[model samples]
Target: MDDITIDRVLKSKDLLNLTDEELISLVEQYVPSQGCSGAAYGYLQIVSHICYFREHLQSKLMKIAIRPIIYLGINDHKEVLGFITGEYLIEKTYKPATEFGRDWIIGKLQLNETLLKDIFEEIVIEENIRF
Candidate 1:
């Protein structure tokens, strides 16, 4: 990634605001090689998992939503950046990133449309808690 791209990513918004296609594009850009499916593989899984859960989370009784959190550490002997679901850390949401993975996630989310209307509509619905 270039300096300009890095700058854009640094200024990008949150991940839940990105469209599915944009997120996929970011995944492709960061994990370019089809042969070595490491970060990209994990990202797609995370997206799918979150989207799948969005419905169940919408229940009045349930009242929960999912988002990815990045973690930086050493994985498989390489310094890795990872994206995972949930506001905080969890075993299931862990997916190690590498190279320019962090930038891609942040960049895609930044080039936003205010909301994701299609695949994630329920996830973004405003809660009217009239307490």
Candidate 2:
């Protein structure tokens, strides 16, 4: 996905108002091919924005939109989890349902527990968050 596309999606006020077809089309266009880290950052930005802005959409719709991007290799999945972790822990912007949705995405991605633990620990340390 290009920066322009990413920016457009992020700036949109009516994200959740999009039809399922529109959302799926955006996901299809935004998800990069495997091993395409060059576009991964932009893709991540878009996905994070979707997660934040469209949290009220059905879980099935979110799964449909996000499932394809999970195939972009383990590293990319880790990045997504890491970003979501930051949003949850540091930003604290997620509502309960949004947090559950993000956790569901993480579960679907099947990332390693150790990697997730490490990511959480690293973020806590970086942000100096107390237990």
Candidate 3:
């Protein structure tokens, strides 16, 4: 909620609506947090955590959405497959690979596969799309 929190988090501020248990599950696989300082840094860290968690959630959804396509070209066209994935990510999440940073995006996937899939299903249905 602080001004310094990443804009991506601000863009989808609904992240705060998730329960603490859901938030904890989403962040369980992330790399350690980076150094930050300031009176508002604590607030910013919480916001950043939510943003990172949701980004991973988006990635999980995208991987499932594109799994069939990815499998088809995983061996012969890995780079092209990456490109397609990036494009789909931008289309669905509105965040480009460049903006999100490939290292951050690829690191620390969600560990709760079944839970994540269920949550994604609940939110992605026709009536729930929030764009």
TM of each candidate vs. truth: 0.23, 0.40, 0.27
lDDT string for model 2 (1-131, tens) is: 23335345556645566765576567656544444333433444455456555544434333433333343433343554554445332453312123433554455423445544454455445646553
The lDDT per prediction is 0.30, 0.45, 0.37
The candidate 2 region of ten consecutive residues with least summed lDDT is 92-101
* Model 1, runs deviating above 4 Å: 1-41, 44-93, 111-117, 122-131
Using lDDT as the measure, which candidate wins? 2
Q: Pairing residues by index, what is the TM-score of model 1?
A: 0.23
Any runs in candidate 2 off by more than 4 Å, and if so which? 1-5, 31-35, 56-131
Best by TM-score: 2
Q: Candidate 3 at 6: error in angstroms?
A: 18
Query: Could you give candidate 1's per-residue lDDT for residues 27-130 as a string of tens digits?
Result: 34443223323333454443333333232321221111111111122121111122221111223323433223333334442232232222233333342212
| Candidate 2, residue 70: how far the Cα is off, in Å | 7.5
lDDT, residue 53, candidate 3 = 50
Residue-level error in angstroms, candidate 3, position 17: 1.7
Runs in model 3 lying further than 4 Å from the true structure: 1-10, 19-51, 54-62, 71-81, 84-103, 106-131
Model 1's alpha-carbon lDDT is: 0.30
